[model samples]
Target: MIKFESENVQKFAEACVDANSIDELLAGFNHLEADATDCKTWGITPAEWMDAIKAATAEKIRIWASENECPELLKAIAIWKNCPLEEVEIGGEGDIAAGNKWLDDDGLITFYRWNAATYGEAK
Candidate 1:
């Protein structure tokens, strides 16, 4: 489970995880914006809030991939994050090296891979 120092950020992150669409996530952010003073009191800046949200979203994706036994997706995430496969904590039976080799051989450019790379490093 992901943990945040700020309670407001923690609640916001949970709301983000339950959100069904971008609009819902935006609404949650708006709610947080309304409580900016409370966030500041907890020493959380807007940037940190965004970072926590991203981390929570990434974790949700990671959990989905793990539960679905989708190692390819996990590999794509790791590749995009530029993180070593072993560090991703992907709980499955897939061979990480072979998956990496296949991804390289296929020269795949998926949304997850592209977007993950486009964004900052994984948390």
Candidate 2:
């Protein structure tokens, strides 16, 4: 998991994860980018900040999946983390079906796909 030394950075990361849309996330990024002092204080470039935010979002999702004991979600997280299939305890076909339903219902399939494509090895 990525850790931010600055509280402001941490808060921004959390807000990004909670954001409902890409536009909202972009707005947050723009706001941060405009604050040169805060950016300098964090001691990271814009690219590094974006990387940190992505890491933080993934970490937050992983934590949520673990807390909820959602195997499908955990599997997705494992894929995003690029862990070997054997390392992730995915349930049977029924679990997979349910997981697919959950992902569709929550409109998270695209989010997972985008996240994995952006940060993990291609399938």
The RMSD of every model to the true structure, in order and in angstroms, is 9.2, 10.1
Clashing residue pairs in candidate 1 are none
lDDT per residue for candidate 1 within 1-123, as digits (tens), equals: 358776767876676667644334334444545346534654567777665555454545444444554556556556665767665444442222323343221122233335445654322
Q: Which candidate is the best by TM-score?
A: 1
Using all chains and alpha carbons, the TM-scores for the candidates as numbered come to 0.44, 0.37
* Over 4 Å off, model 2: 20-44, 67-86, 90-111, 114-123
- For model 1 the TM-score comes to 0.44
Q: Please give me the total number of clashing residue pairs in predicted model 1.
A: 0
Q: What is candidate 2's lDDT per residue for 1-123, written digit by digit as tens?
A: 446776667766665566534334434443545345535766656766675555444444444444554545555545654665445442332122222332321233344445546657312
- Residue 57 alpha-carbon offset, candidate 1, angstroms: 1.4
Task: Compute the lDDT of residue 106 as modeled in candidate 2.
Answer: 23
